[model samples]
Target: MDTLSALISHAEPKANLFFSGNLCGSSSSTDHPAGGILHLVRTGEMLLFEEYGLTHRITEPTLIIYPKGKAHRLQPQTLDGCDVVCANLTFKDSPLYRALPDAIVLPLNELDNLSDTINMLFIEAFTSRFAQVAIISTLLDLLLLLVLRHLVENRICQEGVLSALSDHKLSKAIEIIHKQIDYPWSIDELANKVGMSRARFAALFNQTIGQPPLSYVTEARLLLAKKLLLKGEPIKSVSLEVGYSGSVAFSRAFQRQFGITPRAWYLKQH
Candidate 1:
């Protein structure tokens, strides 16, 4: 897969719709974490105040995503009509998170491409009919994908994994590393694959990705190892699968990276 697809594959993002209701008076929401908060305004209007004292007025049929999870307050404009659906989004930790903004607001006009999905979400949320939960959950997932796509297409994310993928040379190198995590990758090999001199490639890769190329390879390997361990694979098997020759070497490297031996980490997770 390409770099963007590979990064997204590792992220394993998911969305959960937790609350849906109407508010008549002013109120504030509880502080959330970096995982993200999504708000779909179905009717009336509300004001969102950020921690920095900035405020945004959201009218009906608008979607707002707070990717940074800043603490904020939401108050209705009046005492009669503000309906909303709120959801929490969770995704695997990655540097890509840094590329996103504090919040992304898509008004009704901007959502023309997603009109059908947005409409379906509102319908499923308000009707509470058969399979409403499943339908809403699916729609929320679609909405999250839409938002990420918008960010990429608009070039709104200028750093982190997304930015690296936007570069031709770095993306090719990244794709190779992701596709061949088990291969013993050297800086020379990665640079050669991308048709660049080793020094030039190393410098550019570090500048674009904020880390050395081999460091990314190691991270990718460890991520794969973690997945294998979680699936009950043997330590030795995971070691070789991720390029380490033996369990002892793998255990040491894993411990250095995560501050715990693989076995201990697996047991705690289980």
Candidate 2:
């Protein structure tokens, strides 16, 4: 499977439309939200006020993304205000979310690759159409993917899984691991697969991914197992699917990682 597909499997993203219209006033801090906030400015001008007195005067069509919910304000600069589309971005708790920077602000022209998609989103937002909400939501999802692709290709993320995925050799190792999560993988084996010395691979993986290689494997397995268990799969089945030998071993590791037994966690969810 492609690296992005595999990565998305672990960090599936969802976007929900919250606002779309001409804005005449400033927005309050959005620190209370659960996920990230995305704003697409279609016209006019505005001022972005983020924490720590960080400010930007936005004069053109722009895309503003907050990967984590943060306290920020958006104020209109022009008397007529700006035409904007906004969405709430939610991602599964995974490396993708953890590795992202606090915020990304760029002109819409900078993402010319997404011009068609952006145009469609703007048109749909302002015009009456059938299934407009669903269409806009789907387009926002696509926009998220394209933005992530831009980050990866430009090596914008300085560290963590996205950074690792940007590295030619490390990405290969990650791809294989995601493809075969149930396989018992050793560090030496992964290093060899990626044609790197085991020692060098271990160090580089830690440097790029911010953790030991095997630790990541265990975390990946447990995270996947957690999702499976939540889907009502039996613990034993989830265990084996995530590479554990038995439910006992899986439960023990799960407890170690999560501070609770699988049964308890499952019960709490329900």
- Tell me, by TM-score, which candidate is best: 2
Candidate 1 lDDT over 94-168, as tens digits, reads 445545676777786776778888888888888869888988999999888877776766666776656676678
Cα displacement (angstroms), candidate 1, residue 182, comes to 1.7
lDDT of 2 by residue, 107-128 (tens): 9888889899999999999998
Model 1 spans > 4 angstroms off:
25-35, 67-69, 95-102, 268-270
Model 2 / residue 55 / CA error / Å: 3.1
Native-to-model Cα distance after best TM-score fit, residue 104 in candidate 2, in Å: 1.6
Candidate 1 TM-score, true structure as reference: 0.85
